[model samples]
Each structure stands twice: as C-alpha cells, then as structure tokens.
Target: MFLILFFFTGFTIIAFISFLDDIYSLPSRYRLIFQFCGILLLLCQVYYSSPYSYWLFFFLSILSVGIVNAYNFMDGINGITGIYSLILIICLSYVNNFITTFIEEDFIITIILSVSVFLFFNFRKKAICFGGDVGSVGIAFLLVFFTGQLINTTYDWKYLFFFSIYGLDTIYTILFRLSKKQNIFEAHKLHFFQILVYQTGFSHLQVAAGYAISQLLLNIWIINYSASNPLFYLPILFLLVIMHFIRKKQGLAITIK
Candidate 1:
C-alpha cells in the first residue's frame, strides 16, 4: 500500500542523491536536505491517525534520521560497514524467528544473502567498490525500520540494545568530540573503529572482525538474558572500559604527566 511505496520511494531518492554526492562532492547542507525530505516522506506515511500515534511517529522520525546518518558516519573503514551490518541483520533475523515476528523472515534472509556477497568484496585488503552513501544510509534506514517495528510490536524498550554496538560508539564519539570543541558535523577519523585501524595499526579486517565478534557476543547475551532491568546499561559500561584500555594499550590516549 501507501506505506511500502513511500518507504521504497524515499529510500530511492535518498540513495540516489547520496550517490551523486559521493561522485560530485555535493555540499553537506544540500545532502542533508535530501535526507530530511526522504525521511519526512517515510514518516508521514506511517499509521498515525491518532494523536498519540502521530506524536510517536514524529519523535521516531527525528531519531531515525539521526541513526541513518550515524550509520553513514561509521562507514569510513573498509569492511566495518559490511561486517557490522551483517551482524546486526543476522541478530535481527534471529529475533524475528525465535522471539517475535515483527517483520518478514524471508526479507531478513534476503538482506543476509546480499550483505554476504557485499562482504566478499569489502572484507578484503583492497575493496572492489565502496558502499558509498547509498549503501550505508539505505541499509541504515532499513535497520531502523526493522528495529522500530520490533519495538512497536513488543512495547519493550530494552530491545534498543539491538543497536548497542554502534550506538555506544556513535554517542560516545559525539560527546568526546564536543568536549574537545570540535565541529561534530565535519568528518574526521574520530570514531572508535577508525582510531583502532588508523592510529593503532590494526588492519581494516582485524578491527572490523573485532567489532563484529564483540557485537555477536553482546547479541548472545541479550538473547539469553532479557535486558528489561536498568542494569542493562552495565554491559555498555563494560564495553566502554574495554575501549578505554584498548586505547591505553595502543598508546592512543594522552597520559597526564
């Protein structure tokens, strides 16, 4: 119906405009405009007939847009996007099968097959083709939709842990940059994965594999223990501690004299 059409059409527009930007180096503001237009169209088509649902969708619209961009921001390293995306998609597919079927399982399988092929090209010493904005943002939008549907169906907020791996890195990186008085919008090699590969001398595959492994572990934990308690944030704290020590071990953190 209208929902499917709007979703695909918006995704197409954003992917197309972002692909152009990848080629021609379009201004950031113009690219944002296209992203907002696409996201807005998708949001408006949701079932928001009631006032509560309308406001809920409105809130989701803003959050989804940020997540879409965050996925793009994390796409800098080779293999990182394809690998992390594969992990998330696989976990979500599991959730669909065993826990709750918010989305079509076949659709999830299709995504898995596609990302597996992408990893063959991307998870290598030399990438054959970069995902470009189209690949990253497009996949981001798709993940957000699946995650949102799961939340809507279950009414459990803890399911947001599905994004814990990327969420931690993105949120912490933004705060870290703000504390350093850097322009958050401008691109830089500040993300944790970027630091691991660029500064620590880890190969792209190593760092990417490390992230995917860690996420796989976390997903296993989330699946075993329901994260309904407030203590669910404990796992994220452990991850932060691990990242801190990793930076220290790699000589990337500044030591006070």
Candidate 2:
C-alpha cells in the first residue's frame, strides 16, 4: 500500500510537470529533474519492499525512466498510445490471471477501461485529444511498476519482451543517430514507424495498428514459451531483422533530418 501510494504521488508530480510542458514547453533540464525524482521514488519503493541488490536497483531505476521517456516519445501519432497500451495491458492482465498473479487484477482492468475511453476519442479518422505528456507518463509509470513487480515475483526476463517493439525502434534510432554523429537528444522523426508514416505515406492508424498487432503476436509467443530458455529471445530477434530489412528497402536517409 505504501509502495503504491508513493509511486502514484511521484507519477502525479511528474505528470503535472509534463502537462505544463505540453502547453508552455518547460525547460529540458527541469523535465529531467522531475523524471529523476520519479525514478528515485520508485527506487525507494523497491528498496522498502524487496531484498536489496544494488545492481538490480540501478538497472530498474534506469529502465523505469527509459520506459517513461520512450512511451512519451512514441506518443507522436494518434491512436498509437491507445491501441498499443490496450494491447500491453491486456497481455499483462492475462499473465496475471493465468500465469502469475503478481499485480492486482483490478488495476489492469481499470487501465484497460480507461484506455478504452481514450481510444474512443483518439482511434478514429480524426483525433479529439492527444494523451500528451501527462497521459503517457502516468501510464508508463504504472506499467513500469507492474512490470517490475512481475519480474521480481517470477524472475522471468522474458517479460521484458513486452516493450520489445518500442525499445527496438527507440534504441536503434538513437544508435543510428550516434553513428552519424547527430545529436540523439534532439527531436527528429527517424523512428522506423515515423518513417513509415512520413516517408512511405502510411497513415498513422495503419502504423499504430501494425505495432499493436506485432506486439500482440509476440505476447502470445511469450506466454507459451519458457522464460528460462535462452531461445526466448529468438522471436524478437527475428522480428527485428524483418523490420530492419523493411526499413532498409525504403532507402530514406536518416542523415537527411
């Protein structure tokens, strides 16, 4: 209970800051500071509830912040957050029920229902309102806490595949920028999904659906496979290769922007 409240309070603070930025464009340093504060709160929760491992704590803090930022970054288009978040929450709910009851089932249902309402407004031919930083960051914080609980309970690294699609795109894009000596922190639209929409003329809904569908398939695979096996990563690797080839075929220069 304390852990939950602590994380929520931290999430509210971070989201409030982000919501302000959505309107006024807050300084990057201030945003980073708030993000770090949220990270510290989550880390404190973990420390209080579980056995301490310095390395694991550090990694979780980093990963939690990364997920928060990645989710926000991917919120570039309409319907993507609603559709992809729906898929992720549904998968997590399933795992909680049939595989391992790591988190509250009610929490999952609440998020699903909330996301359903959000999807109603945003998933159509025209969007009414965006999730913005507040919506995205709040949801990301919830997911990170739930995912951390699952990992701690089941000791299953395979669960990390939940964010596989977004992680691949974000990590690869950053690396690609680094390779070109570009400022990775600068805003750009070189994400493969972005390229699909901007360069290849794919609609936002189509690209969003593509990611949600791909992730749904991956979740099904993970649910059936043994997390302890080293081969659990093979499917993600295969999908990454396919995505790479597809992007390569587009022949768009990442250096252009």
lDDT of 2 by residue, 69-187 (tens): 99988988889988998999999999899989987899889989999999999997689978898898888887877787787788777788899888898888787778778987788
Q: Please, what is the whole-model Cα lDDT of each candidate in the order they appear? A: 0.80, 0.84
Q: Give the TM-score of candidate 1.
A: 0.89
Kindly list the per-residue Cα lDDT of model 1 for residues 1-257, writing each as its tens digit.
Answer: 76788778888888988899889988888988888878877665543332346677767777778888888988987898899999999999888999988888999999999999999999898999789888999888788767867777676666667777788889888886787777888777778898787777889899889988888888887777766666666777899888767755766443211
- Model 2 residue 198 CA deviation (Å) reads 1.5
Q: Where in model 1 is the C-alpha error above 4 Å?
A: 44-55, 247-257
Q: What number of backbone clashes does candidate 2 have, counting pairs of residues 3 or more apart or in separate chains? A: 0
Q: Tell me the TM-score of each prediction against the true structure.
A: 0.89, 0.94
- Top of the candidates by TM-score: 2
Clashing pairs in 1: none
Those runs of model 2 whose alpha carbons end farther than 4 Å from true positions after fitting are 254-256
Query: Where is model 2 poorest over a 10-residue stretch in terms of lDDT?
Result: 248-257
